[model samples]
Target: MKVVSRIINVVLVIVVLCSLVAAIGSAITKEPMLLTVIRSNSMHPVWERGDMVIIENLKEEKTIHKEDIIFFKTEEGSLSKQGWIAHRVMSGSREEGFITKGDANKYTDQSSDGTVPIKQEWVAGKAITIGETPIVIPKIGYLSLWAEKFQSNPLLIPVIALVLAGLIAFGEIKFTKKRKKKSQGMELQLIYIVGGLTIAVIMGGTMLTSGQNLGLAYQVSDKSQGVIMGSDVGILKVGDKVSRPLSELSNNGAFPLIGTINTSDKQIELSHERVILSKGEQIKSTYTVKAEIPGKYESSIRVGLFYPFLPASLIYFLSEQSYWLALVSVSLVPGLPLMVYPFVNGKMRRKTAKLLRRKKRKIQSSLPF
Candidate 1:
């Protein structure tokens, strides 16, 4: 048993080291790809919470397998945006994009255009082994969520990273205290972990409260004065703030007008076409967007970012397997965590276990095991 434990310890250490290396390697080896922890059980038995996947765009002609883990773009917002989802490829032709279904679900994601065709180019790389073990990275989702707050304001990333690293280090402390009842202790530990996850969901939502429900960020391609895009909006002129698609423009609702915002010294600029002017007329001005929408989640949600469908399909898929329905159903929002404290507490507890034990002793001096 001692030998086995030593092996386990060695294994754990190797796992931690390798996971760290893979994470860093993934970050630096490719054009930086965001590490998305799978929150839904869809890709399950294969992917679970805490699994860290290194996503890199697949090169042209890379052969895809029937079950090779892949991520694809969906026009159906409920499924995923290019920036939004990480799921599994169920079926498809290289000539046609593969049909993708969450492992938890029964069917594939059906594109409105038709069965989605994954040309050789759209695949994100397969998830190699996680850390030193074969486990997936769902456990890391909580950490990724916490780490994101730092990304919003890069100044805080290092501080956040240090705190997270410290927490991870703390969880690694040797177990010095013996439990009076191992089963009860383990149950409490499991409950605590789940509780923490619930809190994390709440916190993720809370952070959304301050930011606009919708956010728009894109760059103007130098080649075109105008272009077709997802959101259709009228350009704001100096005095024409609320024009429909902005004065003499069609509101197709898919393409937002393209422009540049120069707020360098707070010198605002507004550019717009004349409301009634002919096609050849040029209109330009400086107009600062006042009272920006207070959340980007809705924009992403409507467009399928904070998707509830992934989780919904996952839950349903776990219970049953209605493939095509699941595919079409991937178009709605999924339930999100409403609390973040529990997850935070889990990390805190792991980090401070030794410290907590010290405090407990002062209160239990008379107790004899």
Candidate 2:
């Protein structure tokens, strides 16, 4: 077990070192923007989906020559699902921006401003290809894609994390007993209990947060076909004490603005309106509310988790999507207890060995006599 623990620790260290190197490289050369797995066939023939390509930031390489495969961000709210894009430079200069086109595509990404030029600020990095063929680590990209899909389910990650931690804690107890030739002491048991409790509390909080359906609930008072002045119909949860910011609803010139209405104002009568929220459109509102009673309560005021709320969904999704990276991080956690156990009990172990050695010496002395 000790030998296995040592090996695992070494492997974790190597993984961490490799990650640091990649991140540092990205920061320095901006080339090989870390390890980005291709998700589309737009760069097919040269690169394909499931292929991981290295990107180098254009900042490091000063020159942006034609035919260079560069990655850049799209215009804000362009609606392109691909957050960042990589394409070959077809025309234009680096001073202003460069015109880019995907090798597999027939038409350029031109807009009203002629060929849409990717500004210097948008250029992420250039792909480091060998002889027109970008280095491809095939099949591994599928793992990343799968992780991303699984991460979308909010509950999956937190549950899995807690389970993994529980398993590690159980394994550690057994291993420690085996090594020490006895059960762990009260101090060590207490430490394990505290750790377990901490994990439990955190997981419980995350679960509660995910299930909380807090949103805007509003109604028209005058009925003059005016915009909903206060809260829009949505899901919201009221928490005891403190306040949090909820979604912001814009009139957008579509609805007539009657006036500003709020529950806190005490002048407006807030009513609950059942609204089937538009999926994927979680609104960010400036309004905040404090619920004296915690539960699903409908009110005109938007309620949010109290200030300093953890972004449970975002955290869980990222952890699940970056499964490989998360595993590497978790591997380190298990190794810590294993390594520390030996150090913490080293004196006792050494004393036991010394006492056994002395007993053997005494028996040998008696036999000679």
Best by TM-score: 2
- In candidate 1, where is summed lDDT lowest over 10 consecutive residues? 297-306
Give lDDT tens digits, candidate 2, residues 1-369.
Answer: 969998997865544334334433332333345666677888778888766676665673478888888877766434144566778988878676777778898867654243357777677777887887676655455544544432234344445556756776787667765655443433344444444443433333322222223334433222222234444422233322223454342222211211112344332233321122232323343443433332333444322221012233433333334422322333334234433443367664565566669778989989956
TM-score of each prediction: 0.36, 0.43
Candidates in order have lDDT scores of 0.40, 0.49
Model 2: how far residue 299 lies from native, Å: 35
Q: Over 4 Å off in model 2, which ranges?
A: 1-32, 76-81, 111-115, 162-369
Best by lDDT: 2
**Model 1 lDDT per residue over 1-369, tens place:** 969998997866554444434433333332224354555666777767656665545566677767666655555445444443455666777787676666677766564335455545545555444452333444645554454453234234224334543553355353323323332333344434443343333323322211111233222222322323544432222332221221222211122211111122122223431122122332333233322322111111000111122454352442234322332333212111212233356654564575568668866986775
Each model's number of backbone clashes? 67, 21
